[model samples]
Target: MTTPQWAWAFEAADGTPVEGTVSPVFTNRFDAEQWLGQGWREMAETGIASAVLLAEGKVAAPAVRLSSDV
Candidate 1:
């Protein structure tokens, strides 16, 4: 079996994928969440309106709004 790959998928307010946003692939969900915790503010400022955790290229969690007004 292959190990699961965890990452965040970022999107704009209109639901399109954010251009130039690259999430670092993680070995576990914890690491992926931790990274988001630290980087979400920056992401929000950089046009990322929301994000969702992805595991093995599938959504692993509900989408999280990065912008407070979103």
Candidate 2:
């Protein structure tokens, strides 16, 4: 079986990912996703308005807003 490559898409307040290179590569999709789940708040604190999970170089999940209420 081929292990999946996972990456992050960092977005701005307007909900668009800032144009640039993708994040560091992750070997395990689960670890990548869990890291995002745990770190998104901190990312938002640092001006990352939103984020999404990328599976094999494509959007895997809907965008997740910084706020929990969303």
Candidate 3:
């Protein structure tokens, strides 16, 4: 079987992918979430309004609002 691909999908307030933002890929969900827990604030500061966990290019969880204003 193929291994699952885990990654973060970041978006702007309007629901479009953030320009210049690259999603960091992980081998598992735990690591992906851990990284987000540590770096979400920085992502919000950089115009990322929301984030979604993706597994195999599909949504694994609901979008999380990063910016309070969004």
Candidate 4:
């Protein structure tokens, strides 16, 4: 079985950002969001925001009422 992960849709060269979730193509789900959050905080400390957590990938989290939002 494969595990799901959280990933952000990144654009090259300071372009627009799209909030999405995707697992690492070749690895297990290593809490992608956790790492992303940590990375983001670390960058914040260094004043270099290269990436942003567009979405939280929770394989088991509750879904929103898409009927209203979508």
> Would you list the C-alpha lDDT of every candidate in the order shown?
0.92, 0.77, 0.92, 0.37
Candidate 1 CA-lDDT value: 0.92
lDDT of 3 by residue, 1-70 (tens): 9888899888999999987888888989999999999999999998999999999999999998999877
Model 3's TM-score against the true structure:
0.92
Model 1: what TM-score? Answer: 0.92
In model 1, what is the error at residue 62, expressed in angstroms?
0.7
Task: Mark the 10 consecutive residues where model 1 has the least summed lDDT.
Answer: 61-70
Pick by TM-score: 1 or 3, better one: 1
Q: For model 1, which pairs clash?
A: none
Tens digit of per-residue lDDT, candidate 4, span 1-70: 5544345443223343323533243133346455654555443343332443333443233221111211
Backbone clash pairs in model 2 (N, Cα, C under 3 Å; residues 3+ apart or in different chains), count: 0
TM-score per candidate: 0.92, 0.73, 0.92, 0.29
Give the runs in model 2 whose Cα sits over 4 Å from its true position.
Answer: 19-22, 68-70
Worst 10 residues of 4 by lDDT: 61-70
lDDT of 2 by residue, 33-64 (tens): 78888877778676777778888989988887
Best by TM-score: 1
